[model samples]
Target: MSRICKPYAAIRTFLLLLCGWVPLLTALGAAGQTRIYDIRYGNNAIGTLETKQETTGSTRRITLKSRVQMKLLSRMEVDIFAEYRHNVLHAAKATRLQGKSSADSKETSTEKSANGYTVIRKGERSILHHARITYCVSDLYFTEPREIRQVYSETLGVLLPLKLAADKRYELTMPDGKRSYYRYEKGKLKEVEISHALGKAFFTAREGA
Candidate 1:
């Protein structure tokens, strides 16, 4: 009878520990905020874009992922990741893959250095002469840049010009002489129109929030 009681007591103790951790585990899982966008070409749905942000103490992590069907047989995907500590850039990386081939992939990485920032692309390294970078292209998806004059492009490894257009929308000029327009409603990003040489693509908020 004593042995039976001991086993029952151990079972109760294990259940108590499990109950204590359930809420903490749920909170940890819910630590990030995610927003989804539907990528469209004209009236056709081509792909989806998802962005997530998570913050722990003073460090913040932001990630963006998207897959687009460029043509009947051509598929392209993009993944971008950035980390910031105390509102300053720590490191960022971007990768672009064509179709299902890794040989047709391109990657760009940027890291914070004591002097400024180091950008690596195509196995070559270059220095960016900046004291600090507080805002980047990824931040534009979550935060409306009404007063921001310039923003860092993690993919291009350079700064791009941001300006308010005559129509009250924000436009960012890319390195390839193409301009992307961002439209915000109620201080939140609602839609983005990106122009390509072949056509245009739009990213509309899925939840409309």
Candidate 2:
């Protein structure tokens, strides 16, 4: 992979998490919903993002998968799975892979603890001593943040501040200073514009979906 594409692994992970891309009707079930969104660069289609949510009794499980090929040069893929109980995060894992055959990989994991949660990344361990993680990045795909002010980023293993614009749009500023905008229509995510390491991209809802 080129040095330029190498730095994008982190940024792409964040962008994929922030945007919900799929142009299909939601498949509802007794346990959860499955949705997909299309990832684009300008007018060019580049990738897809899929999210699945399931519930069992009091536990809720969410999984997100994304694949992107930028300029036909490098490809990056990320998958995240999280479980929450009673609106509190219990455990989560996120994996990122880069290259044509997915030769390079990195992982971050979180687990509930007595106080807060334990985070492990690249084999190093850390601790987050906050209370409970009620809302996370994954929830953005399924629900609009009307009254939410903050959310936990499972990829970054940190809490990110979320703002509601006067236009009813949601805005998020990453730690690296990149900004992303999300718009919803009929309580569903319709569009997301994001600034990333490779410039700007968008995830828009597919028409007739």
Q: Report residue 129 deviation for candidate 2 (angstroms).
A: 0.6
Error of 2 at 19 (Å): 10
Clash pairs, candidate 1, are none
- Put down candidate 1 lDDT per residue, 1-209, tens digits, no spaces: 55433332222211111000011222244348688888776677877778787778667777888766634446667788888776688898888776688998888888999879999977899999998887888777677676688788777778878899999889877665667788988766788877654456678998755
- Candidate with the greatest lDDT versus the true structure: 2
Give per-residue lDDT, candidate 2, residue 80: 90
- Model 2 residue 149 lDDT score: 83
Lowest lDDT sum, 10 consecutive residues, model 1, at 13-22
